[model samples]
Target: MTPEDHGTEALSGWGRTMRRVCEVRRPDFDGSLLDAVLGAPRLTVRGAGKSYGDAALPVNGVGAVLDLTAFDRIVSFDEGNGVVVVEGGAVLKDVIDQTLPIGWKLPVVPGTERITIGGAIASDVHGKNHPGAGSFGHHVLWIALLRSDGAIVQLSAIQDADGFWATIGGMGLTGVILRAAIQLQRVDTGWMIRNRRRTRSLDETIAAMRAGGTRQELDPERHVVAWLDAHTHGASLGRGIVDEYYAASTLDLPGAVAPFPETRSPGSRRRRSLPGPGVVTGATIAAASAARWHLSRSANSQLVTMRSALCPLDRADGWPAAFGRSGLVQYQFAVPPNEVGTIHEVLAYLGTHGLTPALATLKNLGLGTAGPLSFPIPGWTLAVDLPARLLRPGIMHPIDKLVAGAGGRVYLAKDAVTDPELFPLMYPRWPAWRRTRHRLDPAGRWTSGLAERLGLLS
Candidate 1:
């Protein structure tokens, strides 16, 4: 082990709001990574750097970072059991491209397919089917973790149970995840049967979603999600389209087994940047929202490709960068069924404050994972993207208080400016996660800006 410094570089989250300068080491060899872990004083492991906040950045805006992009690889696959072993740095898109053609896909996935396997586990990301399939951690079978003491240990729900669950959503503070084995869901085809409806108000939307899944049903694995028009106010507040779909059971649909949507190669597409800072203003969002709402109507059941169903936004190249250099902030929070009122409160606040988001999505999450740091809890979750320039300092403070009071917690993966004092209140199980993290790395070698800000580091 050697205490050598790598070149320093500036980094930011997907939101492009939080920026930091840190020493980064991109070790292509496994031995070099081990040495860096054993020698670096304060370090954090970075994956694809897709987290909307500072979860991948170093502590206090400075420290050593282990870049694992070159470490990406699909180790093996078992067609019999639909299990695939992949390096932590492997992107989900690549995995989908490899497996989807063979009639298998990840059991659960987030909004974007560009993130790394390590990132999916660290965030315990949930998708539209969260009402049934749960989050990413639920699909993980085992993990190879590199601890601060330089020992590479295998973890599972049964083996080193505490470490396994903690690292699931511990935001990489537990240690550096080298690789993991995940279970894949079987699909006869790459097409989905979509059942969409336009809700008239917030109550109607909630009723439609609750009446749908998130509980027992003929097709328990059905995916359900809602798109909200944030520009609406008063009676129209929360009016949006609710969609529920399941994989096509038959191969009769058009393009039922179409080749995997070719993911964009790096630098292959030119992005159209926003012309001005206020290009995404309230007026613009209102017009766009209305157009989208009116245009969403279609047959109750229609056939669409999996890629179009799961990650529709991928079609727009560099959409985030379109928010201008200041980037955007994605605020996502979850609340139990009884506390559904919190959603209305937040939406009302946004309306009163005139903060219209470009995109807002809502879903019903089933029971959460045993991982103490996991974000979902059997309830309603809403996510909205707001341009950084549109926000005022402390604007989110009241929303945080409301969520915590309702016994809900914000998603740390997309959170950039959550109040440290309120984090524990929202996540009451923080102490348990902290204890497990400390047990894994007592020297506190693994730390990130998110951990430091939210007091996750011991």
Candidate 2:
């Protein structure tokens, strides 16, 4: 049955692309899901609906959309070795809640806690400590993939190496990921010891970041993320605060402390009450356009704990509602190690051109995996969030050109406005990835807005 045949409304995403490409089916079990996918004209996988753009949207004229939320589960966990195997649809927040109490945590997490493990793997997402730990894909031990031909294969570094790499950041074009084995890190406590420093300009901010990052002992975790005042100019341009965190040693733990709270399943009623489109839009724009002066003032204040500074969204009820109706777009890109200075240049350009992104952050990234389409590079990366209202014609095109000119490339998972022409330049491995997909999905059954826009599918 068509998606409309089921009386479902048009399926879209945070990017606001309104289109009906296929019938969507939510399957709880992998076996049934695989059967449906294998029998479909084509298929694409989706999780949590967290993608900021049309990357998760089915391509026009083919395929069914497989929503994996029903498959969410924490299949297994090993507290001793900090290894957690979870279903592809399990939310990061759920994983964190289960593990954090035992003095363990996911090695890497994106800004939002609501994202699914599959989405994290698909995006190869990086976080505050990217310079040290790299992308989430790096810690992945294995993945169970359902190939287009209906075969289930478990891939890892030493086994099915190429497929493992491709699927890590392949944007679900390689296959439908069934589950993943992830490595977690040990922590003394659920708390984070943080340090916050305010810099005067872009140069100082970079220097401060470099300085903080080098201090392995002081900030052992090396969770360094900066908040740039995109509207600042001249001497104050790129002015922002750097927040760093380090895991506390067990011996150094406080004399009196509370243990991590118990894991509680959110009620079905609460989940059903998630804010609708209009609410999402209002919250995101308000948060994005609020007075920068006050924000800077608050960020300049003293450092706080993990609960206070990092992952603050976890504290609020229905935190996802913060994004508002149009939802949120997290635009991230990376530049080569030698070209780190360009980050400042880009920030300055944003400020001067009155294109100040509402939120701007910088992180250092390590070498990437063998994924033909993975986004990581051995360099520094920056992530920014923009309200949809600011996507004026005159503004976005020039910004896209600027990033491309600086030898930087946008993160496909987080992008909604990148130019189709710039795709090949950003991903030199695109041709190889396309070749591999051809072998698996010869008929081009799996497609997305990104695949079509970037010529990944015909």
Candidate 3:
């Protein structure tokens, strides 16, 4: 061979929050891959890079990033048990396409489809139906991890409880997850029976959501979420639309030349990135938020696929351009029931600043796994995508304090900016998590930009 050609490139997550110049290594899945990368002084694992924040990017712009994209292979599938074992780098979209046709889907899927199984497990993401379904970690059966000392081992909640929980939401610091076996949720159809209701104010929205599912008796597993109009304030501070969904019962079309599933969401097939930053101004954001409120009628006429219903903005096609190069701050935080008013205060703060929030999604969350750094808990969770420029000390810092005071925690997977000092307070389990991480990688070789920023290594 003439030579093994290698190239260096600046990498950033989907949100474009931070760019880091580093050496990227795409190693074939092999026995020696662990020894090769562990030789490097510092290393971090990256998959899909769809996290939209610093969690995937390493700090200090040094060390090699072991890109896990190439290792995406469906290793095994046991249809009888509804369990599938795959490599960590496997793309979730591919898994969905393969399993959906067979009446199975991921128990917990985040806002986007372009994520890796490793990334999902690392983040321990929550889905729209979190109150009923819990988080991504709940469905994971086991994982194969490679340690710094070149020892590879299989970890599961039962056999290796500490190592298992540590790696689940460990943010890739515990070790490099080589593969995992995850249980998939069974579904009868691919379509969603969509229902939309209008809430006049924030309190009404909260009440409706607290009722669970829909005003009308609906399935317990109904996927319900809300969209808040950031421009509305004062008496109208909580005005938004509450959408409730369930997998539509399978149906045969009257004019069907070919057989089709009961719920066909053509949206999952569509994928588009930003052509450019485009015209995303304060005025446009306000108009969009208003449009969502007005466009969704109180009636239950909307019908959509699972993909479309799960992430409407992703279906917008080229929507990420609105945030542009600065990438949006996917500021997500969860506060317990006592601090529910924190949402009102934060919304008021946004309204006063005249910063029309983008993609303001609200969902009632359930308790998380024993994973020390897991994000969700038994409470209401709000994920707001704000313009990166507006993430200044005055705005971001106060919100951080608001959450920290409520004994809440921010989502590391989606956070671009959060105080390091408050991190320990937000995640009280971090002290234990750090202990487990050190035990796994005693050399402190597995580290990332997010790890350093949030003082994960500290």
Candidate 4:
């Protein structure tokens, strides 16, 4: 569809809170319109409107939201070598559907598949195998960037290295990502052979996860994500299981599907028919409730192949409806490697303080990216989803202080409660990032809620 077809008027995202600075412009695959926006008074790029927080929201609505969805295309794919190049607006689900049938898969993916490649790179998203694969940016070979000065720049580790590092996880403040070449991993089959082991204590769960990380042959697709009963106390604290897996070859199986089956729809049929904020919220809540119930049951755990275990979110229609009307906020933070024990302590505190999140997931990240405000580090990261109603001062504020004290910082892409003062403490590279950003965007034309809250703009 053309820009005018979707309406030239400004549009908000799925969150509906970040209104555009100027009229939304949907440019075709070429870089001409993007170049114009870069030279305009102010500009920012947006895709899919799936970002949980405000990373894609233009600051002050002064510039325009350069809608890149129109640029979607898979430029090339080499199944034998497992490398694919695509435009920035290509959705993760789209890539997976095309690649998985050929025994290839994205190296990493976030919880949701509705996100665009540009959005994923802007957030530098990670997945269950982050301890091994690192963030998505690590797998990227090069990117086509529309620079602040209206120049189309091709950046890689060796070419334009400085700009490349600055743009990855730069929250798209530096420029618009036009296209990217990513390296995909080879898998034996579309199915995952999974192992589910239940642990009675947080310590046991941690030990199991650490042990699982050492087994290279297993190449697990999922990890330890827990469902802690807030009402449970003391000895029963942090009781959960770790689910690990490896891709299983389906060559010997009869009538095995070449590509994986689509994910089951998360919301009800009636709910799917409805539209607007109210219906979306209700659907999200219902989905979350079902997921929580499923996880809570201690059923027979056995081995399952990759396709069954690592289902992409978008494949399951109506999945977005699970968060309900108030919507869900994913609060993730990383503490020092030595301070992971502190995460358990914080969980205990949350249980006692009546702030236990609905869902809690943990991962071990390798190192921090060079982005001025990147979130990962050589530490353990925990992500939790909480209802917006729980964001009151009495609850979230103290939790923020606790995380800060532990040398932890919230993920900006998932954050809605982070206090501005903690930005410098969590991200030591902020000053350097700001320096690079000023050099590229001296007028600070590009901005977002994250930038504004963290004082990233001068």
TM-score top scorer = 1
In candidate 2, what are the lDDT values of residues 1-458, reduced to their tens digit?
A: 22332223367664453346557776666667766675677666888776767788876655668888877889999878988999999888888878888788887777667779998998888777766777889899999987777777898999878778888888988877788999998876665666677677778887887776566324336687777766666887666777777765544455665545343434322222234533444344335534543465423323234444456434443433344444446678888767765776777666566456656778766667788788888777888766554465546556566667767788988777777787777888878777776775654567777777677664
Clashes of 2: 6
Query: Residue 444 deviation, candidate 4, in Å?
Result: 3.4
Q: Which lDDT values do the candidates have, in the order given? A: 0.84, 0.70, 0.78, 0.67
**Candidates ranked, most accurate by lDDT first:** 1, 3, 2, 4
Runs of candidate 1 exceeding 4 Å displacement: 1-5, 214-220, 254-278
1 or 2: which has the higher TM-score?
Answer: 1
User: Model 4, 40-69: lDDT tens per residue?
Assistant: 576667888776667766656456667788
Measured on C-alpha atoms, candidate 1 has an lDDT of 0.84
Ranking by TM-score: 1, 3, 2, 4
lDDT of 1 by residue, 1-458 (tens): 23474788888887777778888888777888888887778897899888988899986645688888877899999998899999999988888989987889998877778889999998999888886788999999999998898888999999998999999988988988899999998888777788889988988888988987644234545888899987887889889999988877665565435544444434324354465563676777889999989988845668777877887656654767778767789999999989878999999888788777888999988889999989999888999999888788889899999999999999998988788889999888889888888889966688888888887764
The regions of model 2 sitting more than 4 angstroms off are: 1-7, 15-22, 60-62, 216-220, 259-309, 313-328, 393-395
Total residue pair clashes for candidate 1: 0
Structural similarity to truth (TM-score) of each candidate: 0.94, 0.85, 0.92, 0.84
lDDT of 3 at 275: 38
Query: Candidate 1, residue 319: CA error in Å?
Result: 2.0
